[model samples]
Target: MAEIDHIVLGARSLEEGAAFVERHLGIRPRPGGQHLGFGTHNMLLGLGRGVYLEVIAPDPAQPDPPRARPFDLDDPALRQALEAEPRLIAWVARTPVLEAVIARLGHRGGEVVAMTRGDLSWRMAFPPQRQDMDNLIPALIQWQGEGASSRLPDSHARLLQLEGEHPEVDAVRAALAERGLEEALKLRPGPHARLVARLRRADGVEVALASG
Candidate 1:
């Protein structure tokens, strides 16, 4: 069965996003390398167990690529949204047999692209267009070797639950159900698409991370 892998937080800059996690969640994420072709980079924080948090942003050091960046960072609306602060933009579901899952879903999930960051590598099924499904549905992932969560230092923050709001709640639920992930993700009818993550700190304090 597919399982929640990680949540993606988008920011204008990696420094800003990492700072937000440290200040608000009381955890400092470790440096994750650049996405060569995508012109983006990330910082990662372990959410305990096999789940983690990924804060991604544009890599200023890299020259603009021919193609648009992932997570719809190049979109004007998304840029405006991030002007104030970083926001939860997407999430990933992990499955051992990614191809099978994609086939079962009739390829609505996206295309599987092999990606690498330093020693870490994985295959991600991204939507045809960056905003095709966006926050309404999750991308599929299959780790090439060991998952990043296993190597990350525990940040003392545990993921409680993940929920979302989408105008097409029924379609989203259907997709998740097809992937056998319906029970792991909760969706409600709403005007716009948004993802919410609930987490608890070691001190027993709970915090919610939402997409704006």
Candidate 2:
């Protein structure tokens, strides 16, 4: 079965993203190494139970990549949005039966592509069009060794719920069900598409992080 692996928070810079997380969740994320080919880097905060929050931004130290970066980081509109604040852009689902899942879903589930950062490695189903159901449809990932969440500093936060609104809610739900992720998130119909994640902090305060 597929389950939430991590949530993606996009930012204008790593520092900005870290600050945003600290401001809301009261915990500063630890540095996550650079994505060499993707021209990005991140910081991570554990959310307990093999789940974490990922703050990702373009790496100024890396040269321009040959292709677009993941999570639409190179998109002009998304960059403008990030200028305002870090946004909860997307979430990723982990599953051991990645190849089997891909075979069943075909192109609808995107293509499996390998990714690496320092000693970490994994393969993920990258969106075929650089976007996946308004980022509400999570990318499927399969870790090579230990999962990234296990290495993150425990922030004592726990994900309570993940919800999203989309115009094509039924189709999205069908796709998620096909991938064994129907129960990972809750969905409803709306004019515009967006994602929201509810998390409980160490001190027992509940916070909601939303994507616009």
Each candidate: how many clashes?
0, 0
In candidate 2, what are the lDDT values of residues 1-212, reduced to their tens digit?
89999999999999999999999999999999899988999999999979999999999999998888988899899999998999999899999989898888788778788899888999998656634788888889999999898887778989999999999999889878887888988999999989999999999999999998
Best by lDDT: 2
Highest TM-score among the candidates is held by which one?
2
> What TM-score does each of the candidates earn?
0.94, 0.97
Local accuracy of candidate 1 as per-residue lDDT tens digits, 83-149: 9999888888899999887777665767778888888899988766633445657778899999989
Q: Which stretches of candidate 1 lie over 4 Å from their true place?
A: 130-133
Q: Roughly what TM-score does model 2 have, to 2 decimal places?
A: 0.97
| Candidate 2 ranges beyond 4 A from true positions | none
The Cα error of candidate 1 at residue 154, in Å, is 0.9
